[model samples]
Target chain A: MKIKNILKGAVFGVFAVSGAAHAADVTLNALFMAQAAYSEDDIRNMTADFKAANPGVDVNVELVPYEALHDKIVLSQSANGYDVVLYDVIWPAEFAQYKLLDDVTDRIDDKTRKAVLSGAWTTVEYDGKYYGMPWIADTKFLFYNKDMLKKAGFDHPPATWEELETQAKAIKDKGIVDYPLVWSWSQSEAAICDYTTILSGMGGQFLDADGKPAFNTGGGLKALQYMVGTINDGVTNPNSREYAEEDVRRVFSSGQAAFALNWGYMYNLANDPAESQVAGNVGIVPAPGEAGVSKASAVNGSMGLGIPTKSTHKEEAWKYIQFLTSQKVQNKYAKLSLPVWEASYSNPDVIKGQEPFVNAAKTSFAVMAPRPTMASYQEASAVLQEALQNAMLGTATPTDALNNAAKTIADLQ
Target chain B: MISYRKTVTAWLLLTPMIVIILGVSGYPLIKTVYYSLTGAKLIAPDLTDAWIGFGNYIRALSSSNFREAIWHTTYFAVISVGVEMIIGVMVALLLNEVFVGRTLLRAMLILPLALPTVVNAMMWRLIYNPDFGALNALLVQLGMLDAYRSWLGDPATALDMVIVADVWKNFPLVALIALAALQTVPKDLYEAATLDGAGMWNRFWRITLPAILGPLSVALVLRTIEAFKVFDIIYVMTRGGPASSTKTVSFYVYQEAFAYMRVGSGASYALIVVLISACLIAGYMYLIRKHGEA
Candidate 1:
């Protein structure tokens, strides 16, 4: 009887030990934007790779629409559900102020610092502390329809806003198209980006060194006047006031517009025969300047990969971030999203695939200025978008519009 | 002693409902009121949550945007509900009569009412698109105009365009209510009027109108409250743009709380809206009660 009792106790001990070990394995939930930057299959594959390397961890990714991602992140932070969040570049300062992100300042070593684009680092750092891993490095590109330009008797894309208008007028007169330009001028975040590109190219800064609104200056008015002038002159689509980026891309991709302004990802989609009527005929260049004031300056449109402060699996999340941002993984996914790694810009394979986009990015990077990085960025952006829309629609002149925006921004600050 | 026991039993019976109401509605209301007195933010701590003692209220009162939003909300509610009532009663009267395909026509009439608000808004947005939209295409095809029109893009027409869309989506509800009220009007009353040598218009004014007035008033009050708090359609369509022409009070609160993240200001704004809604409801109830008594 004693021997049988001992044997039973030993078997029970063995079962309990294994069960405890199984329960100790960690599972993480990640929130990502449902954008074209990464395909579901690619995300799944990357997670599978992570799982194989670390067998004790399981990851579940939830895809959210771009518009809903911010709200979802905030809700999940309060509920303590999401372990990792893919955040926009403009959100870090605000999120950091809320203490919603884990400080990964120490995690980002000197090697990682040297590897990424210098501009990308500016996005994820707040108050001298790093909050995220630089994942995407993005900028806007000037996309033109080569066929439309050739039909309009132009061999090259316009280098200046004046040249663009001249070409647009010629195209309209020649009956090539009713509107030679299409813009994403809707009152959304994209409007701020487009306006920033134009504003910076005309040597205008959104704010002075003291962070007061300086967009009411001469250069700012000129930029606004030029953009609204194109529409008034019937060179750009009249419906541009209602268009978002995708709407503008559609017009250009359908062979209806001579020029458009869109992000780097549109290059692939616009060249794909399945999606575009102007396949193999799309030409990319720097956005136009005001002829002599400055060169075309692209606005930075990057996002960061960050671990939420409420995450219990912070160590595991860091591991995931490291794996996701490694040179090999970023290189493998370069076609879907541009790599943050500086070295990848010179990779022969990357050069072969995205030469035009990379070349424009190079010029844009040298002259790029970041969006207003403030905790009240959303308010500032809304104010600017409304002002730009008013200017474009002739509800208010550029001077009046900027003055109103300045007052609002001053109050918000 | 027996009465006291019965009172205890009654209180016990009502306990669950009271608890549920407190949990679902009372708590949020209390929280909103509390936040309104403090400087709070949706995402970040605002000024350490210390009481500001009507600071937010003063700001809201001083802001020109808030005044404009109030004007917009009132304008939208009055015009939309007024137009909807007239059209709804007429449609209800038309549909109340027996016809060959009465059942199918009744079903088709209520289809718009069955659609989700967001879906209806999106459908209208597509229809109102300046380029290749159905409205422009149909108008041009019918030779109503020579060129395509930016119906929603133009500020002069933006709010009215939204009102039209809202009417199309919402009139069916008012019609359904009116139709129900119309059913209650006695056929004997109409027959008596006809025997008295009364014409169609007289019968409508004397019998049909009075019979449906109470129910139509109820429908009006309900839709008026809803129209005053309109946000989803505006968000999906104009985003309160063309120079803030359609910025309703509810949209202003939404922008404050979610977009600008100023929870304190937003909460104060919401309480103000609720007060307005309460006054409107109270006045409507008094008028209806007086009419009923008369």
Candidate 2:
């Protein structure tokens, strides 16, 4: 009888402990990239803030290299590897199509939805549902060396493609720089991005309203012609074809190029006296468009935060997302990235040191175009990059290259 | 009856290895074959269990990109392997002779082989950089040209430049193999040839050449197989750029699978390549067997 009573007491104790453990607070895992714009300390501080605001929740953040994040997401889709996922702009539509992301339409409040920039909001929308929240709003701007422009006797940045060529030639003729323009035209994702800026400025479309390949239209040929003409006219470096975006920024920062087209982040990096030779001699402006063709020159590029569809801690993840994207938190985020919240634009802290970006963004945002949203965007962009490379290298005429790419894309579909 | 029992016991002893080989290699091969006949994507719900027999194979075979890639891959393999073999033999011959610091020279020669292929590719990319690369800087300093030429940006030179990088990374392996073979060659043969009043050319042609052919053929086959599947260097340095001049079969397969996310087509493309490779390897084995008999 004593042994039986002892067993009954032990069983009661085990059940009581399990019940207590089940009542503990929830924890959520987040996967993000350790890019130049978002550091580990930023995530750590944000997690701390979120934890303080919600005493019953804990957050775990896993940061990976930018190059590995895409493959990681693709591999982790089935397992819902993380409760929250940070992804590039190109990913929302594709991830949503594969049912890898949660439909957070109801979770986002109307006021919060209306607070983000329209261009950034569009990146997170697909098939009439929202899959993510925009975290950073990015777009390219024309960066020029003020000393080189002054040496060439130009008081302002070029406003048109014709004027750009003329100014570049003047700078080249004066021997201010061997190449007046340096571009990120390497045949990879960067090349396609650079091409999109030119294509949009020339009023060309990558896909028509019917969603067919339309980049080989008249405007497309003209854009390619202008790009290749720069090399033929001795205004841009022949080495441009081999350079990625960082390489172009490196050239401009070293006071070697009269002009460069890069993302807004380049402004801060190029002005640091320790890293740049022409720290204070830099001017930022809108990228030039062809005369009477287009006023829009830049493309919208950004990353978003989302919850995976299979996550079990949806409530906790949503709470953390709201805390991280709040105006106060985004205001702090602006130090490392452009603010996604439109109201943060007028924040004195945001505009204090980044006047050029703020001013340029006002115009750029109004005209920013996005790359085509497709499940197979990687393949599509690759075809476009190859076509541009073929035309630039003189291996194929612009018409032939684009036409071939059109056929290939049709096959891919 | 006793012999039959012995054979059964032997088969039972080999069961674990057979099961392991089937589980590791055979399972994946069969799954790949099955997937090639189905409509599959690399990610998510699109990776379904639907049958579309031979459709992916037909589409890939008819694609222009695949055709161009086949030609480029073949050309790259032939050129890179041929050049690597010739240079490897010459280097091996030179290193085999008694000289000052022979051991140091031997170690230095294999350094490129020891370095990772990805690192070698990146180093070559820096060297080929037109604006600030060592190649252009050195050429300009030597007054060889008035301007820096874009080596990788031009279509005509991109493939050749990639080939040079591949050769630099792989030729050392072939040289090391030839060096090992050279040590096996008897010194008395050279002495015998010299006593017979044979010239240096005759001595080398009659003795060294024949003695090395056995190992040289093995090296050639190995290098050829490796060159045909070249991907990392191409992926890094050129990415088959300047007009798809360097896109090898493996790179094409990778683009289809990961970039295009078309697992079905990628599997079909891979199977076709495997078929071709199997035939080539069979021929190589036949040649090796024939050489051994000779």
Q: Could you say which candidate leads in DockQ?
A: 2
Best by lDDT: 1
Query: Lowest summed-lDDT stretch of 10 residues in model 2 chain B?
Result: B41-50
Instruction: Kindly list the per-residue Cα lDDT of model 1 for residues A1-413, writing each as its tens digit.
Output: 99999999999999998888769888889998766466677788888998899989999989876656776777676689988889887888888888989999988889889889888888798888999998877777789888888988899999887898999999999999988888888777777778888888888888889999888886777788888899899998988877776788788888888888877777878888998999899998888876668778677778889999999999999999889888888888776677888898899877776788778877876677688788888878878888988888888998999999998999889
Instruction: Identify the runs in model 1 with alpha carbons over 4 angstroms from their true place.
Output: A1-27, A35-60, B44-47
Given candidate 2, what's the lDDT at residue B184? 98
TM-score of 2: 0.90
User: What tier of docking accuracy does candidate 1 attain?
Assistant: acceptable
Candidate 1 all-Cα RMSD: 5.1
| Cα lDDT tens digits for candidate 2, B1-294 | 569889999999999999999999999899899889987887742447479999999988998778888888888888999999889989999999999999999999979998999899999999998878899999899999788888888878888899999999889888998899999999998898899999989987888888888888888888877887889998778878876777888999987877666788889999988887778789988988887898
Local accuracy of candidate 1 as per-residue lDDT tens digits, B1-294: 579889999999999999999999999899899899988888644455779989999999899889999998998899999999999999999899998998898899989988988899889988988887899999999999798888887778889989999999899889999999999999999999999999999999999999999999999999999999999989778888766778899999988987677888899999999999999999999999999999
The TM-score values for the models, in the order shown, are: 0.93, 0.90
Which segments of model 2 are wrong by more than 4 Å?
A: A1-72, A78-84, A310-324, B1-6, B44-49
Listed for each candidate, the true contacts retained, as a fraction, are: 0.46, 0.67
Looking at model 1 chain A, report the run of 10 residues with the lowest lDDT sum: A33-42
